[model samples]
Target: MLRKHIPITVSHELVHFKQSPLKKEHTLLSTSIREGAAEFIAGLISAETDGTLAEFKGKEITRLL
Candidate 1:
């Protein structure tokens, strides 16, 4: 599972690097949005989504629903 996610991880970090004016607010909501954006975009860019497993969690929940 960890190995499968590496590409997404790298892409996620790269997305963070390219992001301008990185948010560093001291609240959970802000942090969640910032990280979630990276994860969602990274999945789209990296093409490492779990279509087979249908985890239906996190980023995929909205699409699944």
Candidate 2:
């Protein structure tokens, strides 16, 4: 079970790692963007629809961003 999700987990953490060095300070918006980018990148790489996370790949958040 855990192993199956490792790819997604690793991708998420990789995004964080890539962004970590550039950030000067942590803030709510920056954290949200980091987390959101992880999910978005993972989804793109996987190319499979995960019902649990599908709700996020929508227009609502896109408009806000």
Candidate 3:
């Protein structure tokens, strides 16, 4: 179980790290993209690429953009 989550967790953290330099408050769009990017990258690295962990029925976070 823990092993299964490693990809997504690491991807999520990476996205956050990339956003750390943002000097302004986060907007809904930015936040959505951040999470979406993490999810996307996670999917790419995860063995289960069917997007079962997605909040919606899409492969990318473009739905929120």
Candidate 4:
């Protein structure tokens, strides 16, 4: 299952990279919080950029309660 998530993980990391430069504190965020936010934004980016978030819908269960 994890093997199938490489693209989603990369997308989330890309989102984090885009946010890193604008965050003022450079403080560390918990993995859950950081990954949750990245996943959410990346989902939106996927929907907009690729016309669907289906590839990442399953990953949401990990980040959302």
TM-score of each: 0.57, 0.58, 0.52, 0.41
Tell me the tens digit of each residue's lDDT in model 3 across 1-65.
46767666777677678765654887899878877776776666764432454575565556554
Q: 11 in model 3: Cα distance from truth in Å?
A: 2.8
- lDDT (tens digit, per residue) of candidate 2 on 1-65: 45677777777677778875546777899777777877888778776322274656664553543
Best by lDDT: 1
Rank all candidate structures by their lDDT, best first, as comma-separated numbers: 1, 2, 3, 4
Residue 13's lDDT in candidate 1: 86
- In candidate 4, which residue pairs get closer than 3 Å at backbone N, Cα or C atoms, i.e. clash? none
Q: What range of 10 consecutive residues in model 2 has the weakest lDDT sum?
A: 47-56
> lDDT of model 1 at residue 20?
77
- The TM-score leader among the candidates is 2
Q: Let me know the TM-score candidate 4 reaches against the reference structure.
A: 0.41
Q: Candidate 2: global Cα-lDDT?
A: 0.69
Model 3: per-residue Cα lDDT at residue 15? 64
lDDT of 1 at 30: 70
